[model samples]
Target: MAISFAQCFLAVDDHDKALAFYRDALGLEVRNDVEFEGMRWVAVGAPSQPDVEIVLEPPGAGPGASPADRRAMAELLAKGLLHGVNFWTDDCDADFERVRARGGEVLQEPVDQPYGVRDCAFRDPSGNMVRFVQPRGR
Candidate 1:
């Protein structure tokens, strides 16, 4: 009953590029980076979720992922079939601008979403959408 979900993993085609997006664009900290058995591994953590990490794994890195699966995932990413990762920030405008300044493509300008959140959206290097939001008037 005390189990905890420590992290969520996303399969990317390029680890270094993903790291650059997460670290430079999203402003996440790279907690760990390493390689094993011809595979590279990296993790990023939010400032508040210091203990929780998001694993950025390359396609076909897992046993269940085959060459075809990797190709399929790459195609899907290119077509923007993946859902974005949403993050809460204290300054959505600041974060959005920072991301754009870093050569990150912002899919949406900062605006008040219908859910009462002021947000902006962008895509990572691998075509994964990521949203940064802040509470209105905060």
Candidate 2:
């Protein structure tokens, strides 16, 4: 048996702004954009990892969610309480500089972690904490 990740989701309040960060800043390729049932989902992925995708979706996009649930989710997303994604890069400092130059909100500069990786963090347009990591000694 074999299992692998295909998609993971992040909640965003604005699709265009998220696209600017993920696609333009982080350099992920846009895989799909679709609207259905009054909700929109945009898929983005690293070019080298074509089998994996991150879906940028509106808060509370799940079915059977109540209005109150949606509101709560929106509030959480606004507060940066939603879970974010981490990406692996070959060059952490270079990727950090590129994303910073492209206007991603810097959460932390590149630093070597005690856990054997060098990483940096940035806030996506919707306040999700995106991180880039490179294994040390690479």
Candidate 3:
């Protein structure tokens, strides 16, 4: 049987803020958000691409998570060091503007890359690193 990356989990300190960045700014679809016993399982994905989902999980969602690990995770998550997520777009400039309007910080403005693409980077509300790219050779 073949396998694929269905989704990736992001342990964030503020799930709501992360959700807003993904749903409101990038216009991703909210697939599921179920809460039980003061815990939640939330996710969002591209509207046209249902298989690619990002689950917004809590820092201590893992098994036997110690206080030190939680703190370390939180710190790394804030510095935009935990993960680097990238999306392909038709227009990087427009996407950057849209993200900026939604309160996402422009870590790097749109620029031509040596790899034959135009890209921009942003720091999401939860400090996650997101890169948007578009082909520039067209």
> Lowest summed lDDT over 10 consecutive residues: which window, candidate 1?
77-86
User: Candidate 2's residue-wise lDDT over 1-138, tens digit each?
Assistant: 999989999999999999999998988999999999889999999999999999999999999789999999999999999988998988999999999999988999999999999999999988899999999988
User: On a 0 to 100 scale, what is the lDDT of residue 125 in model 3?
Assistant: 77
Highest-scoring model, lDDT: 2
Query: What TM-score would every model get versus the actual structure?
Result: 0.89, 0.98, 0.90
Regions more than 4 Å wrong, model 3: none
Candidate 1 lDDT by residue in tens digits, 1-138: 688768887767788899889987677899888899778779898888887888887765777888898788778877778546888888999988888999998799999988889999988888888888798878
Between the candidate structures 1 and 2, which one is better when assessed by lDDT? Answer: 2
Residue 62 lDDT in model 1? 73
Please name the candidate that would achieve the greatest TM-score relative to the true structure: 2
What root-mean-square deviation over C-alphas does model 3 reach?
1.6
| Candidates 1 and 2 compared by TM-score, better number | 2
Ten-residue region with minimum lDDT total, candidate 3: 34-43
lDDT of each: 0.83, 0.94, 0.85
Per-residue lDDT tens digits for candidate 3, residues 4-119, read 88999877777788888888989998999987757677988998787889888876677688889978888888777787689999989999998998888889999998989999
